[model samples]
Target: MKKNMDDVRFWPGNIVVAEAAVAAGCNFFGGYPITPSSEVAAHMALLLPKVGGHFIQMEDEMAAMGTVIGASLAGAKSLTATSGPGFSLKLENLGFGYIVEAPCVVVNVMRGGPSTGLPTQPAQADVMQARWGTHGDHPTIALTPAFHQEIYMETIRAFNLAEQFRMPVILLLDEVLGHLSEGVIPPKPGSFEIINRTKTTASPEDYVPYDTSEGDVPPFAPYFAGYRWHTTGLNHDRTGFPTTDPDTVTFDEKRLMRKVTGNRELIDKVEYFQADDAEIGIFAFGSTARAAMVAVKQARAKGIKAGLMRPLTIWPFPNNQVLAFSKQVKTIIVPEMNLGQIVYEVERSVHSDMPIHRINRVGGVPINPSEILAGIEEAA
Candidate 1:
């Protein structure tokens, strides 16, 4: 399986993700082997050393997340991969990454579950968890890619967004897509823009880690880069030191959220299929979107004016785009591997009396094209 970076190959989604991260300049990977996501760590172990980067198999999920955060602070584009239970363990440290503005990516190859429900099976049950897994108020950025090629591109974009937004970005991969193999021609280096964190030019004496004077997102000077600033889990002020003052805390929290929410247009993305003249819209993402796309075509064959709205960015939820798409269709069908997680978001976006239907599946099995087409047919 020897191949160059740009060479086209039939690769599994996890392998493509690892290669894309390498191309995106991910210099550090710290993760533990977890079901449905071990290939990502396995490949990273092989790739990082070739690029003079570091890869560590941590003791557990929490330690793995902490290591990536440390690497990011020390000026490396870092990442970690895991599944549902492991993703849960990473949340506390993930919360730390959020408050300290560590730019790194967390890949959750989702499987069945509230607990360790299914190790090798697929599920979209973690959609809501990815958004609210960490405690307290914070901004979230999560991406869902439906195919092998998309998984490659989106993996790079995940790192880009993490660096651009100065926060931890989540890449949600279901078990089906994580293991799915297909032909992928990864973009050659320098073909696409690769963004790194904005480093501060301020002198060490003048540097403030959380300084918002320039803008909502302050430039971050990496640790050991002749810059000194406090990093903490507690709410902090512009100096990055812990703060208890009501106004300072209020301002700090709002600023954190504003960095992402204020720049929604730049962070949000979606894909549309035959939606321009649709009477029925299918709202789906991740591997489920793959089935939804096929179902859309099948419905059209039956003269059903059906369309699909596949969101690549899931966290910020793409509310405005969903709202606009909802307006054009008389009814919206929400299909997900989980039991109606995203359906609620669809309902919220479409304030009109338009009927919103759902095709929910929680079994380890994927919703096939026929099942989704049947759902669309029923809605039509």
Candidate 2:
């Protein structure tokens, strides 16, 4: 099983991503049919049985999540793939997954959205949605893939992060990356790192599902191995029992929050491309970032100093890294396939009054490079 990354052959990124997940021991996939993301589901459907894994195409988004959470509880590395609307539908279940500390991946092939916003269009609009859509003080791990090849690699990373944090990890995609045909050299089966969900060791008689030390990420024991544990949405105690003590709830909430939010350095991911003394920079994510990259180079060719800030991890925002570039640039342009979404977060983080322009396109088409280049100049 020894292989080098340099020796990897090219493949369609989604297929490589899917097969990598299979190779990483992702035994279960429950997803609904949605554009861009449907390939992941289709790939899983065909390949899972060959490797003795499970794949279920649910009747709807809700069912997809239901199956995902159910499978996760049984100690299977499980996940569900969907776009905007379907991602929205899975929020409640996402919350359930969070509180229960179930490790699974949620691949959101982001399409334009508020309500079926633009089914075929690419959007980073879900950037905020990925952060706040799910209820309460839970943490998130979201990775954005700008190209077909990274989609395969990042999906495996998402699973590793989920298992590491014992939280739901999101693979944020757009129509562009999901559907883009590109070559990827997938790692051989068992070649890439794999992380499994943590199991409990307190014994059934002394099990405390919510127990924790400083970090409070309780050791997670799998279900039905003669280990009795309870999981509920209600605020609970070390043993996973409902608690009314304000102090206990307060401690539990903070612990849950710290496990992910406090460890931003561990989760923050970004691609800072050519930001050395750049006057005009474009900030973008997912498929829109791909278009921005093209525009940035074209602008660079025209004697305008331009570059791209592409974030691999969207939810944690990589704000520290992004804002550092924002301070020096005269313009920080954000382009997406939605009317306006990520621009707000950028605006909120940057202190200077330098114009933060947004270039957006919706109605089933990706953002044109020309439009984004125009936006970059306008901001510049």
List TM-scores for all candidates, in order.
0.97, 0.92
The residue-level lDDT of candidate 1 at 216 comes to 83
Q: Model 1: runs farther than 4 Å from truth?
A: 1-6
**How do the residues 113-147 of candidate 1 rate in per-residue lDDT, one tens digit apiece?**
78899999999999999999899999999999998
Worst 10 residues of 2 by lDDT: 8-17
Task: Please give the distance, in angstroms, between residue 334's alpha carbon in candidate 1 and its true position after superposition.
Answer: 0.5
Pairs with steric clashes in candidate 2: 11-184, 17-152, 200-220, 200-221
lDDT of 2 by residue, 1-380 (tens): 34455866555445666776776679999989887678788888998999788998889898889888888878888978888889999999899888888888888887775787777766667777888998787777889887755777788888888887888888887777776776566656767777775676677887767767525567777777777777787888887778889998898788878887777877888886777878998888877787788888888888889988888887776667767888888878888777887788788778778788878777777787888888777766
* Model 2 lDDT, residue 7, Cα: 63
Question: Candidate 2, which segments miss by more than 4 Å at Cα?
Answer: 1-13
